[model samples]
Target: MNFLWSLFMRKPALRQFALLDAQGRCQAFKECNQPPVGNGWVEIDEIRLSWMHRPLPARARVSPRPAQSSRHQPLAA
Candidate 1:
């Protein structure tokens, strides 16, 4: 039974990447099974001067805002 359940269950895939805007600020942190593609975005590992507005600082890091929790939702008045 355990083996059958495992076969049916889908495993989650993990991906970590950061997106920077024209000003070099962290616009978003993406996590998906497949690579994300869009305008004004590039992978953190790749280096492309054309995609970046300016050179990033050596100590620069991408720290996007934390995901909001459902518990914080306001009750409808």
Candidate 2:
């Protein structure tokens, strides 16, 4: 059982890679099973992993104003 499982279930699926242009747009996609074509391609999975490690920019914080009373005395009619 162990031998059969190792032979079949141990293998992982083919990895998918995205080909990007100079503008960082995806032009095409290719899997690991396919032969390499042109350059400027990156692994789709790596993109998400890299983004998770990136730091976010600081944003300016705004202070809230004090509350004002809206009640007013009635005027003579």
Candidate 3:
């Protein structure tokens, strides 16, 4: 059983990278299965002087405020 499982099982996938342009705008954001394309890697002419990291920025979140309750719903006790 162990032999069969090991043969079929593969390694985990790597997460994609996110980048920011010169103007600090999010130019590309996608979970790429393959390596980065042309002028995508670091120290390239296309890439501007911006920060690049494995994880996304904290400010990249979109948490809107809860909508006002038009109807008063009963709370479940």
Candidate 4:
């Protein structure tokens, strides 16, 4: 006998939505905002999202530059 539980089941994945203009540029997100009245626009109803998490192992170290000989030079008017 097999018993199924809701806690062990995976949740349904949701889709993202976006509005694009005539030049294929993103104008609005979540499909909640109203688009312009007279222009060629496209609606993406089922936009999938990809997420990732990556941590860098090490960071680069930068050293300061040495002082130039202009330290003792006088200022000109």
**lDDT (0 to 1) per candidate:** 0.58, 0.50, 0.48, 0.39
Q: What is the TM-score of each candidate against the true structure?
A: 0.39, 0.38, 0.32, 0.27
Tens-digit lDDT track of model 1 for 1-77: 99999999999856555576777755566666555787644445433344344544544444544666878776896
TM-score of 3: 0.32
- Give the lDDT of residue 70 in candidate 1: 78
Weakest lDDT window of 10 consecutive positions for candidate 1: 42-51
Scored against the true structure, residue 9 in model 4 reaches a CA lDDT of 77
Between candidates 2 and 3, the TM-score winner:
2
The sequence of per-residue lDDT tens digits that candidate 3 reaches over residues 1-77 is 99999899995655344454654445665454444675532222232234343333545433433666899888895
Pairs that collide, model 1: none
- Backbone clashes, each candidate: 0, 0, 0, 0
Candidate 2 global TM-score: 0.38
Alpha-carbon shift of residue 4 in model 3 (angstroms): 8.5
Write model 2 residue lDDT over 1-77, tens digit each, in one string: 99988888756567656666666655565668443577865555422333332331112111333555598656886
- Highest-TM-score candidate: 1
lDDT for model 4, please.
0.39
Clashing pairs in 3: none
